[model samples]
Target: MENEISSKSTYRLLYRVKPFLAITFLQFGFAGMDVFSKVALNQGVSNYVLVVYRHAIATAVIAPFAVILDKKVRPKMTFSIFTKLMLLSLLEPVIDQNLYYFGLKYTTATFAAAMYNILPAITFLMACVFGLEKVTLKSIHSQAKVVGTVATVAGAMLMTLVKGPVIELIWTKGRNNQGVKGGGTNIHDSIKGSLMITVGCFSWACFIILQAITLKTYPAELSLTAWICLLGTAQGTIVALVMERGKTSVWSIHWDTKFLAALYSGIVCSGLAYYIQGVVMKDRGPVFVTAFNPLSMIIVAVMSSFILAEQMYLGRVIGAIVIVAGLYFVVWGKSKEYKSGSPSTDGQMVQDKQMTDTSSDSNENSTPEVITLNVSSRGGATRDEQINRQSDQLLV
Candidate 1:
């Protein structure tokens, strides 16, 4: 963690300099979680079983906070809201985590994280269509938002199709030295892991957009998170029951390295991550919150290459840059545009009130002169002349 922020300047700015620093760190934490899980799996643990624990522990971790908030701050949990929660759990915990872990089983964590760069772009498009976000070109902020989204998306696609080195990287120093490879070739010769990660990104994107909606209806961030995990736990249990095929092994408590991995994921990545995401999204919107996908990719890539001795590619570095550049354009532009649209707000109201008063006075006074206007214009006064004529008559 100390090495995670080597530069004092980077720390002061990233941890303190920016407005959305917390959100940025949250995204980085998610990436770090993925890297750690990958390290744990190389030590020999079923990814699916690990996921089962992730949701379970995540539920426990978030449950108390949820309960307190549910009792006090969050909205009353109507069946309707609960139903939405259930649906959202399916998208996030069930599909999102499942696809991610499954993809990790088949692919490298770096590959998965790299592919996740699509999330912000997907979230932006979905939010815009859902009317949860607004995008315009009249302002630089809007332009940045749009271009950033495009850059992230384009980078994701480029990584997938660019035919870069997707090699397996085994850590020779580790007990199991056979996990690393040089190419992304699967036994099936397909980028199934990459595909699965894309699905994961897409599902998470939907989860984000829906979350914006969820917050509107149920503003209790803590409560919403707890219930979402609860629902995900239910959905995951059912799937694990069916997929593991009557084998209770997936449910059996291992409490080993794998369980610890899950615990970290549950407590930090899921529970705390949700809390942080909710808090930031309240200020930053889903687009910017999700926009840090590239940062996560960078974390995963760097951690994999040096810590795990995985092969790093020139393309990964370049693609990451492109994605980050895109994110910069989008978030900066969107925020700027939002600010630009707001400055005239107070002034506009004041000017409107003054105009209304002037019009009303003119209407009241001009009515008496309305009939005389035609005659006044013939020999009678014009709009300005009438005022002068009235003044003269009053003086006489």
Candidate 2:
């Protein structure tokens, strides 16, 4: 009886911490991608080629599952949905990723990772502009979101403009000179890279917003992901062919870091991360998933220092801290906003809760379940609710 009781307690504990463990592992996976991609870039992989190959591999890895699993509830694709899929492909996989890789080429992985923390702030601003986010001056949570966005932008600016003395760690201490020479320490390159990364963040923010819009019509998560990957692969190839016109050698892959980078990022980050986050988000909320994003930055900073001998700057450390604080404030505000029970918000929440309960019931009965927006009643859901739901889906 005691053994059985202990087993039940253990199971309960595992159930409770499962999300945390999964998210932490995802952070580590993302951190490894940054490190590996950097190594591949250093070894002469073209950023454009990398983008194309990455999505191709991702499509291949994810397509079969999408076909087999999402067959029952996959929405019929319309011209509008197809158009949005193309734009989505253009935004993230082609533009954002190529720019991001170029930025990563010119900057350290740690810096690129740190700069990505501004994504939520950018998304919030875009949502406000589109009227998908209601900002009440009287609400503390609204105030928090505005203040947090400002702080995040300020932190990003500081990171861009300031370059303080390097803070050497045990791994990077003795090789300070080598690190300084090898790292992206040049002022011009730093500024250029920072611009690219910031622009990429904006593009990524746009992608998130548009994805939310797209999900209203096409709601099968796996199928939609496969479509994005497949379309992105095609679009990225065209861009790569144009950009890498004369460099046929850049397309060549061998049993090397470049191939591994593409393989790992496609399989782990793009493919598996999507499914895992979706599963976790179904249990917890989207906010819970996004709350762990900064963990990837922290992990990247540590791993880059140890593996790549990347040097940290005082300005960067300070900027990273401020950005994390701002991120926390924004996430806290969002959580509160969701909990605030205004009529429309409450209605949406109740509907979502009912959907979740229904899905849970189906799962218990060993039936495949897919959560989809009721197209007939789509007009009833407010833009804010739609955006919130999209945020939940795309953030994965």
Best TM-score goes to which candidate? Answer: 2
| lDDT over C-alpha atoms for residue 40 of model 2 | 91
Q: How many residue pairs clash in each candidate?
A: 17, 0
Question: Which residue pairs in candidate 2 collide?
Answer: none
- Residue 307 of model 1 has an lDDT of 60
Tens digit of per-residue lDDT, candidate 1, span 266-324: 88887887777776665456776788778888788767676666566656767877887
Off by over 4 Å in 1: 1-19, 163-178, 181-183, 187-190, 253-255, 341-396
Tens digits of per-residue lDDT for model 2 on 1-396? 576555655644564567778978988998999899988988778999998889899999999989999997688988989998889888988899899899998888888887777776677666557544667878888788677776776676666567699887877776642444226778788778889988997897787667655654565678877888889899999999999899889999999899999999888877777556555544433434545566677789888888888777888778778777876776677556654433322123324544765777786885433333222234565434544454444333
TM-score of candidate 2 against the unseen true structure: 0.79
Worst 10 contiguous positions by lDDT, candidate 2 = 341-350
Q: Quickly count the clashes in candidate 2.
A: 0
Task: Give the local distance difference test score of model 1.
Answer: 0.68
